[model samples]
Target: MQKCGLTEKSPGQYVDTIATDAYVWYEENWQHDEYDHSHQRYQLTYVEEGYQYFHIEKKIYLVPQNHVIWIPTGKEHRTTSEAKTVNLMLVLFKSVSELEFYQNVHVFSAPAVLKEMLRYASKWNKVLTEDTEQQIFLQAIQNSLPHFCKESSGLQIPVPTDSRLIPICSYINANYQYHFDSDVLADKAKMSIRSLQRIFKQETGITLQKYMQLIRILKSIELIDTQQFTLSEIAFKVGYQSLPAFTSSYYAIMKTKPKLKR
Candidate 1:
């Protein structure tokens, strides 16, 4: 396993100097299947090409392209790639006073300026020899952190821990393009419709119907960006029976109308 961040000389030891502890790098085809772990420094990850999923606690967050995911120090989390080739720019640094506001896991849109800065920093993964040059480099990243912290709505789904719901979720992920009837899902879970509904809501914090819609919307985003299908065709392919309903649902979840990239 190739870790990109700087390894501390001593465990659990807080260092005061920001110049020595900070690390930055860019990676391609990055995939990690490690168990949940935490570090002493905060991690800022920007997805430049493909999508990635982060498993934190009981929730799963989907981070798409041109977005950022922030992990605070000592927060246990793990990441998995959603695409075959995922590109990313990552930074690991000590929590400074200016960055204290980002103490929780945050997923947001990355501005162009921050993206460029990260790209520039990734070019030199080693510490600079000159004191003045190192100070200039570190200060540039520090100044841009506040600007990149703007919050935008991102997709996050609650993962149910109940054993019975495991297969149900897997089936939905594999066949979200087909209509999912509540009764069928209830039968699969070996529970009555009402009992299944109550347990699903209690465990995942969302209704079964809403969960299916969210899955469809996520799949629609990928299809809209990759395939040459028309919006109506894409809607039908993602299990939406009516174009208006699909458009309305897309707007509600993505906060924008679905459009193909020219």
Candidate 2:
């Protein structure tokens, strides 16, 4: 595995092939380039910090901090980072039970114990020397897999396919600080207000306003984790007129108070 800083121009990347029965473990602390690729072995990717986006089958899914994304074999996907520095753990191994829990791409929350196990597994990037140790690590991870399936948190929002609605989603993501109304969003999508609402729901299975709120809360969480901005600043930055409203919405979605760590 190579260790380097990733930039917008040149992002760091690593790929390992599962020749026989092998499990590859590595951690990447940099942004990744966007490209469509596939591997023969099952992949379990955990985001330790920062955010990552995956574009699969024309839909984009946001993988936030402390989240895990499971990609099955032969699934062509493109990945990119939403932040400048993204710390990610990549585990590639063969598992017959890959489709037992999830058939398509899935994301779940990574509990503290699983996080430590992944960190421990990151040491075996090149090869596992001891068969007994490898079995122990594999058993530990498999035992914890059922818990992950039960505690799966679907934190992803699928990008719409309608060309008209694409700009509206992009506008909200880029200018999330601005107060938006359905009229403005309808105008951007070049549709009537009712049409906009109906189509957004049909395409994304979420109301426009609710989707915007989800975006705001997720963005605020990212900002809060950075510890670079105060809660008030983050509130305003994500388009809340007041801190109370921001806090209320944060609690509604995240079930916790928004705090900025110094």
Could you say which candidate leads in lDDT?
A: 1
User: Residue 221 in candidate 1 has what lDDT?
Assistant: 69
How many residue pairs collide in each prediction? 0, 0
Candidate 1 lDDT over residue span 5-89, tens digit each: 4443443233433355566667888866446766778888889877788888988777878888887887878786646567888
List where candidate 2 sits over 4 angstroms from the true fold: 1-16, 20-22, 82-84, 128-130, 150-154
Q: TM-score for each prediction?
A: 0.78, 0.82
Candidates' lDDT values, in order? 0.76, 0.71
Clashing pairs in 2: none
**Candidate 2 on 1-262: residue-level lDDT in tens?**
3321111232323343334344645555655447776656566778877778787785666777778887777787778764646788776655545446534677777778888888888777656353667757855675566567533333566688889988998888898878868899998888999999999999988888888888888788778767788888999999998999999998776556777644
TM for candidate 2 is 0.82
lDDT at position 251, candidate 2: 78
